[model samples]
Target: MSADSKESSVRLIITGRVQGVWYRAWFMEKAINLALSGWIRNLNDGSVEAVVSGLRENVEEMKKTSWSGPPLAKVDNIDVGIYKEKIVNSGFRQLPTK
Candidate 1:
């Protein structure tokens, strides 16, 4: 498929008081609700990282919402990365801390 019309995918690294919180779990639920597929995990630097794939709007919405996170989270920043890969629907998951 052409890159322009391919599915959208985003790699987000969320910083701040995100660990020890329910961020990963909550993000998984939200991603699923948006019918997205990808993986989420805690970074060794006390940040949260996720690679979600779905429609452009859904992915963008989720990315915006990630900055706020769950009620207990104190998100400071969310870094988005650009990658070259097709988004395959593989279902969302929470992975071990990296």
Candidate 2:
């Protein structure tokens, strides 16, 4: 949230053995560590969905690490999209399944 730095946000739909493998928890931890803001949740479709917003460089780092996820997760694919808005007053959290 600074004038000099560009904000970057992304919607990540992670698939393949992501749910039930601590992905959301891991995501929360990683996002916080990166000083990013957003939320992560489980989708009924068996994929994990997350929205991350922060510094452009931080967002890029998140994308690089999130592809691998936690050790137990078998990440087959990640559907990445440009997220336009930041979640209001929200920090990184693990949301209930949607």
lDDT, candidate 2, residue 52? 93
Alpha-carbon RMSD, candidate 2: 2.4
lDDT of each: 0.87, 0.88
For candidate 2, lDDT tens digit of each residue in 30-91?
99999999999999999999999988999999998988888899899988998766466467
lDDT of 2 at 30: 91
Give the C-alpha lDDT of model 2. 0.88
Q: Which stretches of candidate 2 lie over 4 Å from their true place?
A: 1-5
lDDT of 1 by residue, 1-98 (tens): 34785468889999999999899999999999999999999989899889998888898899888887889999999899864576568899989988
Candidate 1 positional error at 93, Å: 0.4
Model 2: worst 10 consecutive residues (lDDT sum):
82-91
Q: Identify the leading candidate in terms of TM-score.
A: 1
